[model samples]
Target chain A: MYIPTYEDMLAAHERIKPHIRRTEVRTSAYLNELSGAQLFFKCENFQEPGAFKVRGASNAVFGLDDAQAAKGVATHSSGNHASCLSYAAMRRGIPCNVVMPRTAPQAKKDTVRRYGGVITECDPSTSSREATFAEVQAATGGDFVHPYNDPRVIAGQGTCSKEFMEQTDGLDMVVAPIGGGGMISGTCLTLATLAPECQVIAAEPEQADDAYRSFKAGHIIADDAPKTIADGLLVPLKDLTWHFVSGHVTEIYTASEAEIIDAMKIIWKHLRVVMEPSSAVPMACVLKNPEAFRGKRVGIVITGGNVDLDRLPWLAAS
Target chain B: MYIPTYEDMLAAHERIKPHIRRTEVRTSAYLNELSGAQLFFKCENFQEPGAFKVRGASNAVFGLDDAQAAKGVATHSSGNHASCLSYAAMRRGIPCNVVMPRTAPQAKKDTVRRYGGVITECDPSTSSREATFAEVQAATGGDFVHPYNDPRVIAGQGTCSKEFMEQTDGLDMVVAPIGGGGMISGTCLTLATLAPECQVIAAEPEQADDAYRSFKAGHIIADDAPKTIADGLLVPLKDLTWHFVSGHVTEIYTASEAEIIDAMKIIWKHLRVVMEPSSAVPMACVLKNPEAFRGKRVGIVITGGNVDLDRLPWLAAS
Candidate 1:
């Protein structure tokens, strides 16, 4: 339950420097002209494991003591985090145990295995996942690195913003999708100390607006089985994430499923980068509420690029 | 036809620097592991016009003297060149006239018009295109900038290699898709003068293997009509480009349509960058002839990113 400090983020950055990519920031003249804002896309999608989670995953893996590294790391995630953590552990020559829903896409499971991660499958329920993960961690004596809630993970994610600001002269606001708030919280953790003048904005799917509600209600509001095309953003805010979202996020903007899909297509069309629907949530929100962002320099975090090309959402029969 | 020299490329680089992006070189560890080569992808796709042609277009447009600039520029191509030239003309506040096939995709025509290019439609035949271009040029008094054959265009395209070399420590060889030979000739123009030890390899679709055959034959062998899924690489090499290809190119490789599509998908899946099928020819050739590139540092140009999301080739029903 530790609040990762600015110092922690700086240390995590140095520790994870060689393990993760300091991905390039891309700009589209067409998007800038369309949105009436100078936009810089931090393409964390270009990370070796195709996600910004690698930043945090590598930080946590590399920061572990030699004795603890020997014990290895474990996490339960069905998305980019699982593969990213496995990739980081492989780089460190340590064991990584991933607890994934048994019915999770085979492609995702294959990615985890490709990175040398051992999988413990669970029934597709939170209770089953927790129980399975607990058993695996107990059996392996592995460090349980909560995907976003762990202080080390948040600090690693915080370094993304530091690189973003360095990439651009400075951004008026930094926007990212909020699922468990790992990325947004990390952005807040860095900007609050590094560039206090910059606004931290969180974007979410309209269907899963728990973060927006929580921000308004002044408390954590967990959603049960919420669904959206932005599958990466279905999770609710945890305590560590809630702390930063409540304290530093200047706004939480939500976009409909249709809008998120449209943004994803537009980005692919113009930015020419394949990324997750969740990553487009920020662009979708900005486009919907243009007046707020016009004339401002906006940095959008394209969090991950893990996509099933065979069934691109845009190509699916509507 | 004038043969552009190394100094011409240097001047073109300076001329077009203000108008075009020094597009980044991206790498994929996954791709490197798959191909058994250290591959550097010079992402010309990230240019404002979404292709490498912008370099040539900007050079041609900006290199024009005030008197010639007032007359503006004209070209006849139904691909990226038309739109890129129009974009450059618009940047320079000059009129651009394009003679495109009337049957060209409405989307492409729309792109040219959006960039303020005036389109003069022609029948979809070489004779009709040349005649229509002549009439348009006569009526508008605009200078003709051949899509790839012009010395100015070749010189401008050569700047790509200058930047590519500067971006990487160095490369054993450079490979690019060769249709009209603008890009490959440019690479030869730069690398021959700058890094003679570096090889210049040309890649082409087997269906459009004129360049490969011509290189072997030691003379220009223009195809009457070559067709492939890589629409951008349909044109045959012109005499101006032939001079550089015959003089400096080390080897020319060809890939089947299936291989090209497979390479495009693999790159999209691993690099997470949306690029044209023609751009993937180099990777396709490399993968097919892995022994040639194994353990070597190779640079491949991802030439463009202009793709229709609704009609992605991979997603099309087989």
Candidate 2:
């Protein structure tokens, strides 16, 4: 139940500096005109590991003591977090064990292995994933780094906002896509202290709108299996992430699958950055509710850019 | 007879500062490992016009005197230059006349028109384009700005290299894809005075290796038409570009169609930048001749990102 402080975020930024990129902040006049908001995109897609997850992964891997580091880290992620944690561990000359569903894409598995992560397959169920990850951690004496629920990981993610705030002049509101709520939670934790005036907005895919429902219900709402084209955002928020989201976030918005893909195309066309569908959720929401963001300085986080080049959504739809 | 001077490039840089974007320089760790070169990418694809041609187009449009500007600027280009010149003219609140091939892609035509460019359609043949352009210029009393041949245009393109040198520590070589050789010539223009120790290398498609052949033959060899997936790199170099290429460029290399697409995929995968196939030639040649670039700092220019999202080359090939 550890709630990370501003000092923790400051420390995480320092700890992860050597291992992660301080990705660029980009602006598009076309997108600004379309949304009627001056949008500043914090391009975490430019991160070395192609996702902002590297920020948290680097912080976790680098913070461990030499003796603890020898045991390395373990996580249950079939997405960018697996690759990012593996990349961070590879950089530190340590082992990283990833517990993923056997049904996960082979491409995802290859990316983790490419970054020196050893994967153990589990049933595509939360209980099975937890069981497998626990076994892997017990056998290797590895530190368990939950994708969003952990204070260290949340603190690491907070550093993205720190950089985002520093890069732009000022933001009236900050927007980030919420899945497990790692990124959104981090945004809240940072702006709560750094720019308290700035409202934190969480965007979720309508198909996977557990966070949106939870915000209205005034409690943690876990979904069994929500589906969306933004595959990375199918997961539910955990206790630690819910703590930040429910308390600090001002509002939650959801976009349809079509809206997400359309927004992805616009960002790719105008911002000229290769980003994921999950990353498009914030922009999709902003475009959906233009009056909420119009004429204001809005900071949008482009969460990741790991997509199969051969399978562009727009190409498939057409 | 109007040869652009290093001082002209300096003046162009100053003049276009308020009009064009000072594009960011990007680096890819994966690309560095793949090519065995410390590669720095000058990302002109991120320009507002989605091409580096904007620099030269802006310089030409902005450098004109009130009388000349009032007459407005005109160009005969069916490529990035047309859209870029139109965008520059729109920025300056002036009329822009473009002489485009009637057979040009509707997307290109639509882009120019979107920016308030007045298009005069001409036959696809060179002679017809020229004749049509001449008539249009006479009708409008517009100042003709050749896409790459003009001294002002060359000087404006040179600003990209000026910023490249300032952004990176010191490149051992600067690489650019050669179609009409505006970008390569611009690199030569800036580096000849700024970093004379650095060599300017030109890359061309095997299908459209006119510049490669011209370099070896020690003369300009204009080709009527050549086909390549890198549609932007099919044009032949003119007298103005040939002047810089013959005087300052150290080597010319050609890459196959497959190689260009492969390099483009690699860039999209690793650099996470949406650039055109024309922009991939430098990296393709670097990979082809790794021995030459190995253990050296190489600067590769990503020329543009105005490709049709639905028609991704790799997707069509597969």
Q: Give TM-scores for every candidate, taking all chains together and pairing residue i with residue i.
A: 0.99, 0.99
Report the lDDT of model 2 for residue B193: 91
- RMSD in Å for model 2: 1.1
Which regions of candidate 2 fall more than 4 Å away from where they truly are? none
List residue ranges in candidate 1 displaced over 4 A: none
Against the native chain B, each candidate's TM-score is 0.98, 0.98
Clashing pairs in 1: none
Cα lDDT over the full model 1: 0.94
- Candidate no. 1 TM-score: 0.99
For all candidates, state DockQ relative to the true structure: 0.88, 0.87
